[model samples]
Target chain A: MELVVFSLLNGVLYGLLLFMLSSGLTLIFSMMGVLNFAHASLFMLGAYLAYQIGRYTGFWPGLVLAPLIVGLLGAAIERWGLRTVHRFGHVAELLFTFGLALLIEEVVQLIWGRAPVPYTVPSSLDFAAFTLFGTTYPAYKVFMVLISIGMFGLLGLVLTKTRIGLIIQAALTHPDMVAALGHNVPRVFMLVFGVGSALAGLAGVIGGFALVTSPTMARTLGPIVFVVIVVGGLGSLTGAFVASLLIGIVQTFAVAIDFSLIDLLARFGVTVTRADTFYDLWRIKLAQLAPVLPYFMLVLMLIMRPRGLMGTRET
Target chain B: MPIIRRALLGVALTLAALPAAAQDSIKIGYIDPLSGAFANVGELGVHHFQFAMDRINAKGGVLGKKLELVPLDSKANPQDTQIALKKVIDDGIRFVLQGNGSNVAHAIVDTLSKHNEREPAKAVLFLNYAAVDPALTNDKCSFWHFRFDADADMKMEALTNYMAKQQGIKKVYLINQDYSFGKAVAAAAQAMMKQKRADVQIVGDELHPLGKVQDFSPYVAKIKASGADSVITGNWGNDLSLLVKAAKDAGLNVDWYTYYAGGLSTPAAIGQAGKDRVKQITEWHSNVEAAALDEELDAYKKKYNEDFYFLRTRNLMEMLVKAFEQAKSADPVKVGIALEGMKHQTPTGEVYMRADNHQLIQPLFVSTMSAGMKRDVENTGLGFKTDGRIEAKDTETPTTCKMKRPSA
Candidate 1:
């Protein structure tokens, strides 16, 4: 029971981190109708920028300045880079962003070398939060939960309560209709893209310290963020949040429980040996399956409901 | 046979473009990843060999021929390595050097052996400075391939020796990357633990996909639940760094006995997260004193703007030049033959090539991460200090290689 509780808490923290990444990509997907495949690369850039900035001015300044830099660059990309490719339709834009991801990884390697930077948590939040049943929960994990929840609350307030939020919502539903009403849809798209990139950058600043900030960080998080957003439904932040937590908890609990197919077969008196057909299958444990479970869920969701859980339109 | 023979001859003709002997420089082909995830580490290796070659050239060159180090980027891919080997041989290079990945190393060893068979006149020696897969020195060992560093099993043996004497390490866990190298490490550790300390409980044995895991918190949770007092892992690169980071974040302070803690960027990234708790076994450490090694190190840092990371290169460079001089030829086959059973006292201790398998037997050092060192990499506030030293004889293990040596 203690193990279950601990795992659940850990899973929530991981899910929150996923949402921080997925929320940004979801906004771009909804507003622009073209998935920004370079979202994770932007996240990686954020981490490297934070490391560089932190080296000079410390971690707090990096937390503020890194995302601002990423946001402005993202705006430039949307305004000039993606805008040019928009002529050839959404696929071309997607492809452009995909290519941009590869380019960013190379550029990062060129600048930082092909190894992880020594980015660390600040000393203030470096200690454990509290000990439960002799297991100490890291303060950084708690900090991650707080920051993610704060971002979620802020996003909700902006979307439901602000005039720009109303404009953004209208733009998401019908960009041409919003543009017809005298609001610049293209500028709105650029703004959404910039803010989305900033969110990803923020995730990187926090997540880089939690995980590893290598050239591979973007590739590592890219597919998984897509999984969260896809399972949640396109353009639905609430759905993305729920899906992220579900996947994170399932993966965490699955890994914690080391149940093997061989052990299950033994209960039925079907002992598997090396000579047995598909013995390798029996050797696999739930822990090994954790990384693939999200993809499996995606497949299941796609087959059952192509519109996705909270998706109002085709995606 | 004509079709196959023609195909082989066509390949040979295409690759035999460069003259074998040109001027007074003996060309050595250095093949490794130069532009990829492992490029940084591979670059480090390239510098080490370059530094060694520079030293050799200063000492009146190898047999009066100035040694030239030609780098061929393998990109750390097995398929790319085969082409890189062909390219090197075609470019008139007789000695090929590589060490980043075992997969690339295996491909080179097999391809070079076949190349040597087909084109004996253009035989190239494969001097491995780093890849420590036991198979390279075991069943797959070849006449053309020679490993300067100790293999994985030998590292585990030395590691277990140190672990056996350490008190309060009652419960141990084995965690490694889910690959051939990792599997070998776990198996070796299990067998050694059973042999040395039958009472030590192996609480948890886990393997994860290499380079795929982003979050290791769940894995660390499992380790803590298992009540493991000490953790043994063979994971390298980001896998090692992330695992150590996860442990630090969770406040699971346990000793990590590792093979690749000294890998590229690991020492710097982990920094105080390890806090003297991590230890690694290698041929030598910066703290280990040897005659004139300090001077060599100073020169290396001054030349490269980095601390010298490669230790076995001392053995590799010295032995290569010695073999070249002794054989009275720049020919690889002759040098390879002379390399076998050749004895030399490296800064660490006396090292010799086992004529049976072409495995270099050198002194091994068990080092700890602690503050204040004579030398450090990346100013990580912590550096490796030698804790225990084992001579070449004690670290030697039996090999299954029945090398097919050529007649003189």
Candidate 2:
């Protein structure tokens, strides 16, 4: 009972964190038809920047300032870097982002060195928020959930109800027409890209302490973020949200399961021994493969639906 | 035409100086991950080696020649280790040092075993300082390899013996990184615990991907549900720090028996939460009852501005130099023979190289993490306090290594 309840809570929290990053990615993909390979790198930069700023002015100031800095940097990249390569088609933009990711990683290493920094949860929220079934849920985790949900609500409001959000949505489908009507389509793209990056940066500030802030942070979480967006759907925010929650919950619960194929087979009359041909493969538990579960879901979703859980567009 | 001539001249000069460079100092190639995920660990090993080399080189040198270190990045992968081995052999280095991963050590031993037989004159000696997989000194032991650290079985034997004496430990959980070393640690812990304390129930056994896990709360939750009073884990680096941090956050109160909890950054990461609860088994720690070693460690920290871990490196280097002096030659074959059944006195006690397996038999210390220690790890104001010590004779486990020595 504790396993079920805690797994549900932890999984939901993890899913919310993934949504924070993937929503921005989905938004950027909708605005520009390019997959930003450097999205996670920007998230890593946000963590490092927050760690730096937090060293002086405490965690709260760093929380606000780091995302703003990252957002501006994202806007600058879109203006000076991506806009110049816009005419070269999507492949060129993809390659440019790929190179940018590598460059960012190297620059981070040069600046921070190759060690896990001491980016810890702030002392203010370091205590247990509450205990459920004798297991303490950290107050920091509660803060993370609140922040992610708040951002999601605000993002949804601006996108659906605001005039700029209307222009951005119209620009996504008919950019040429939006520009014909005197709307600054390029500026809209830049705004969307900047906002998307800022969202990722916000995720990093909290996720950094939740996980670890290291040189390899980008590389480790890069694939999972991509999985979240791709399995959520290419450019669908709703799809991203559902996919993040599904993957997060599934992966977390899977870690609690110690059953293997051998166990399932043994429930029947079948018995497998060490001398079996693929004993190693047969003996692997779902718990052991929790880290790889996200990628496995990605492959299954691609083969089965391709358009993702709630995606409208097939692409 | 000028550029081409200059390039040719550079190549010829490099080729001309290569042999002369080899003659000036006996170079021991240090092969480990100096880049990628395990760079910090690899770099730490390098610092230890460099410090040891400097100390040895200060004493009028070995065989009248200063020992030079040749660092080659292996990226902590077996395939990359093989590549580094090739580079070591090609560069005419007859001694190589490696440690971080047991899989990498396996690769080195396999490559050098073949290379030693195929080219006896250029055979390289493998000095392993840390990779403690029991298989290295057992079924997979090589004539070219010498392990300085205690094997997994020996440490587990010592650790479980200590745990058995503590009447409080009724239930134990085994969690380790999913790799050769981690598996060896788990197997040894289980086997030894059963032998020592048959009444103790093994509550949980889990293996997770090495260096990939970011959150260990789920694993901690399972341990909590299992009602384990203690956890024995072989996870190192970020995995170790993150696991302890997660457990502390969740208020999961269980004694942690770890192999690498005292490693770089772990003490700082765990902070005050780990005080008096975390224990580690190692050959030496900062707070051990050895005044000379404490002075040397203090000096090392002062010089490098980093905590001086890896006392095994000092032993390895000193033994290597002793072998070089006793043999009076740089040839790996002669040194290998000299190193067999060799004895050296450490600050704590005397250690010997077992001729049967080339595994070092050293005294192992079981220490508990405590606050208000004279020496702390990673500046956490918490350090290891020695609980008990297992002598070299007690640490002995029978080896299956039928080492095939080269014909004299």
Candidate 3:
């Protein structure tokens, strides 16, 4: 029972982190209609930038400044890089981002080398926050959860209450209609792109301290982020939020649970031994299956309900 | 008419003599991860060999001719490795160096063995540097291949024997990255524990996916609940760093966490946060005070702006050069015969390549991060000291290889 509760909490935190990264990707895809393959690379850049800034100015300054730097760079990329390629259509735009991802990876290797950088958690959050069922939870995790929720709330307000939020909502649903109403749709696209990339950068900043800031982190987290965005639906933030949280909890719970197929067979009084290929399936662990579960869920959802749970359109 | 005939005869004789004395340059191929996540380590390996080759040429060339190294990027993938190996073979390279990962090594070995059987004259010689999977030396042993590093069983035997002697070690938890290397290490550890330490109990065994796992809290919590005093793993690269960070964050009381591989010698992998949390075993260390190691260490540090821990490739290359020199030829068959049962001294220590298994028998160093070393150790000049060195033992175990030397 204690393990279950702890895993659930862990799952929620992990899911929230995924959401922070994926929400931006989903928003950008919905608005721009081009899947930015380099979104994860931008996240990696954010983490690397935070690691550098945090070394000199401390962690708190990194938390605020790194995302802004990433946002401005993202704006530049959208203006000069992606916009030029957009003339050739969405496939060309995607290819550009794909090339951009490759370049960013090389750039990271040139700057940081290939070894995993050891970005430490802040000393303030180094201590355990509280004890649950005789197990202490680190304060950094609670901070991660708080930051993720705070970012979600900030994004919610920006999408709901602000004038820019109203403009974005109009553009999201009907770009042509918004352009007819004298709103500069192209500038709006640029803002959304910049803001979306900033969100990815924010996730990277928190994630770098939370995990190892390695070049591989982008490759490792890239597909999972895409899965979350796609599973939650193409244009629905609420759907993305739900999907991220669900995928996280599922993966967390799956890894924690261990039950072999042999155990199931044993319950039915069936004894089979010395069979080849039995060892292969019996040796499968839940944790080993955790990484592929989200993709599996994504495939199932795509087949069963093309729009996803909260997706606005079939994508 | 007589003068013209004499001139034509002299020119024909000169052209014939040129083809006999000057042979084609011996091409050695290197295939490994060169452009991906594992690129730095792979590139370092490449650089070490290139540096060695430059020095060798400067002294005077090998076999009275210059060495041409042909490098192909594997990207640490088996498919890529297969393609690269085929390309090397097609380019008429007889000697190859690889083995970054077990899966890639296994694929290359299997393909090479098949090719060797079909065409004996085109047989390739392999020098495996860092792939430590035991099966490659045991069940998958090849006559044409030589493994320079310690295999999984050897490392596990050392680790388990050390753990058995230590007091206060009760329950052991086994966790590893779910792959060929990880599974092999875990199995070896388990077998060693059962055979050596009866008091030690294995509470839990788990495996996590490679590079796909971000949160290690569940696994940490499981370890805590299992009441294990020690945790044993074979995880390397990013997985090692991430697991240590997560385990520390979860307040898991790991009295001893033995790494079969990973962060064993690389300071970059462990960082400042992990210095106190883990102890590593490796082939070489920067602070090990040996007379033979000092000169090589100084040269490597001066050239590479980094410590000398990534010298496994250099050691392997030196061994290859020695074998070739001893054989007095670049022939794979003669080189293999010369290398078998060969004993040489390395910067690390004396190493013996066993005739039976072709696995290098060398000293293994166990080291811990130095206390009072500041976090800026990479920049501020701090180093690790060797706590123990396990010398080569004579507990002879039969290798799984059945083939005998073909009357060489």
* Residue range B98-155, candidate 2, lDDT tens digits: 9988889989999899988999878899999988888899999988999999988888
Write down the TM-score for model 3: 0.91
Using TM-score as the yardstick, the better of models 1 and 3 is: 1
Q: Which stretches in model 1 have alpha-carbon errors above 4 Å?
A: B1-21
**Chain B alone, TM-score, model 3:** 0.87
Candidate 1, CAPRI quality class derived from DockQ? medium
lDDT of each: 0.87, 0.88, 0.78
TM-score of chain B of each: 0.93, 0.94, 0.87
Q: Which portion of correct inter-chain contacts appears in model 3?
A: 0.80
Residue B173 displacement (Å), model 1:
0.3
TM-score of chain A of each: 0.97, 0.97, 0.95
Worst 10 residues of 2 chain B by lDDT: B263-272
Candidate 1: Cα lDDT at B69: 87
Instruction: Give the per-residue lDDT of model 3 (tens digit) for B231-265.
Output: 88887766766677677777776844555323322
Residues A1-315, candidate 2: write the lDDT tens digits.
768998988789779888876777787886676699999998999999999999999999999999899999999999999999989988999999999999999999899877777788899989999988878888988998898788778877888899998999999899899999999999999998898888888888988888778888889888888899889888777778888889889988999999999999999979999999999999999999998899999899899989777677776
